[model samples]
Target chain A: MSMPYWRAAGMTYVGYANACAVLVRKCMKEPFKSQTATRERVHFKLSQWLDGVPQQPIVRTSDDGGGGGGGGVGKK
Target chain B: MASGSARPGSMRLAKLLYGNVNSYLSSGAAGINGGGAVWGSTTGLSSAELAPFGARSASGQIVRNRMKSVKSIQKITKAMKMVAASKLRNIQVKAENSRGLWQPFTALLGDAPATKVDKKLIVTISSDKGLCGGINSSVVKYSRALFRLNGLDGPDKDVKYVIVGEKGKAQLQRDSKKLIGMYFGETQKSSICFTQCSMMADEIIKSNEYDAIQMVYNKFNSVVSFQPTVATMLSPQLLLGDQEVTGDLDAYEIEGSDTKEEVLQNLSEFQFACTMYNAMLENATSEMGARMSAMENSTRNASDMLDRLTLTYNRSRQASITTELIEIISGAAALEG
Candidate 1:
């Protein structure tokens, strides 16, 4: 039996839609990879900024806490 | 999936038939069709002040779009898997029960009436579009394999095909040389057509035109997966590849509805109608399931992309701020000097 002409067009449209959809995904994939790279760069920059700050001394003295030891520590 | 199978020379003829869609995708390339989502609004509090979701031109925008699109696809696939599962449950039940019925029916009748074989036809049913993974392609390949077995590639093979859905039409239309006839839009009709499908079947069966008939369709196995399978429309023996077994007689019952022979006589039609009815429901459910999964994946991807974009915007703004601050301090020190 023969089918309606419109149905053929409709089916074609579906193919058209699928074809479009698939190609779109193919196009989107490359850009997505770029986005990942950009994100990684941002993280790299942030880490650099944190590393620029000062660092604490490896060792410390107790006398520094007494403010030059103006007053006696053991005897009144 | 229109025909539940792929077309001959599909790879070679890709441009001839599906070229229109290729053009359409190109036209929409700037957006999701190309590589990016709509830039959307970059307005409001100025945290990042990126353009609107639909307005951006940067890679960030494309990233957002792609992420969203992929997530949606995953969601759709997942859902399709589930739907196929439920539909599979019902279909499998029917298939199991019908197998028993078909066994006896075929045994009694020996073989479906060959009336007057002349015309050759193959009807393949698939969705208009494709999103489900291998559901359509596998069926198409299966159909092609059958034709190959039947010597369609040989000079003597004069077979004709009538596709039942959009996907099948696409594949067939691409490979026009092999085609003898076309039937489109059977699925778009108001209902799963036993009457129409049977009419089509009757045309071939009653006329004895076609030597054999086959259907390639997605058989739901579980909620997460579906198998595209080929079922024989004529000569189940072809698909089943089994030897005919002639056994003893077992009479059927019929009070007012006529005897078992009556039903058995219509069994071919009955089976055709049942196949069409069940396939319609199952296919729809599977389609919806795939779409649902695709959409959910898109949503998640969009959110992730937005997060990354916001981070970039903030860092850029902060860098600009720090530069200004350092300049201001240096200028003041110069005045003091």
Candidate 2:
């Protein structure tokens, strides 16, 4: 069976759909453009657990600029 | 002899009037002390303040402190309400728009009824922070009810849970610790994007153990109401095997060169992400709405409490002043005599 473009490109359907969503958010007009841009920004705090105890967290923040896809699980 | 008799009679009458006045003053003082003692418990006044006449100042001090705290609390709730209101407005629009991404899939796939599924995965969506009224609890209760309905009487062997958000995990952990397969957190700290939902969906799909996945979330009905809703997505294998789904699939023209099974698999995965994205947005919107109403109620309560406190403070203050004036007037009359 022939593979879909995303599948051939080594990306899952979810990754393709998310990429499309990001593209759509970027191509919008002003006001909502900035709004979705701000909305798309992500902030996360990563912490490692050892033997049922949690260590200090490391905070990470990123702004997803127009289709510059970062790590899907780690950054996005 | 006549003047001596008159002076003794007058002295007896003077003593009688003074005794009556002293009793009246003491009785009035007793009433004030009683009020002070009752006020002490709520106002957190020291025992020393229960002394005669000292209660007036102490009572005023306590009322002021209470008013100050109430005013601050009111300010906080008011600010929280405003924040929730604005956030609701923002997320509500996004939630409405995101519904378009999944509604077509729902129409195409139809709902896969939960009656005969062998392995079921329930995905519950909740928030991290609380004080948002009963939204989280309602979601949890709905999931529990679902568990009960699915014949999870004792050990919950065939059923598993994929909890999204910290609140859901915290709550579901108590009863079904072993039943939880995965947990996701911090999805509500900022705006929930499609990527995050996609990532969550990917992880859930990776497990590939369940025959069907049921998503439980709070559906936004209006600014004041939300309903606990469950939407089910059948696995690709289940969809392919079902004659009704296959019949529905035949209606749509397949554009890609891939086999029908491959296309169905891709569609199923994509649909999972879409549903999850929509559900997260809807739950987030509902959470903000719940919080807005909660904060509004609290602000109103704080103001009402402040009003009652002010009335009591003013009444006691006026009473104390009147009592002092009475004492002064009685003392003046004795001196004049």
Q: In model 2, where do residues sit more than 4 Å from their true spots?
A: A1-11, A19-40, A43-70, A73-76, B1-55, B152-157
Each candidate's DockQ:
0.01, 0.22
Instruction: Provide the lDDT at B117 for model 1.
Output: 26
TM-score of 2: 0.77
In model 2, pairs of residues that clash are none
Off by over 4 Å in 1: A1-76, B1-120, B152-155, B189-208, B235-265
| Candidate 2: CAPRI quality band | incorrect
lDDT string, candidate 2, B1-337, tens digits: 2232236668887786666556656656646446655444333456554555644587687678889998998999899999999999989999999989988997888876564577888889998887788888888898888777787544544777777777887888887777677667776666687766776686677654777888999999998999999989888888899787788878879875767788778888999998999999999999999888888888888899999999999998999999999999999999999
Q: Candidate 2 lDDT, tens digit per residue, A1-76?
A: 6677667866667766666777787789998887766545654443333333334644434544333333444232
Best by lDDT: 2
Candidate 1 C-alpha lDDT tens digits along B114-152 = 222233455566676665445555556766665556563
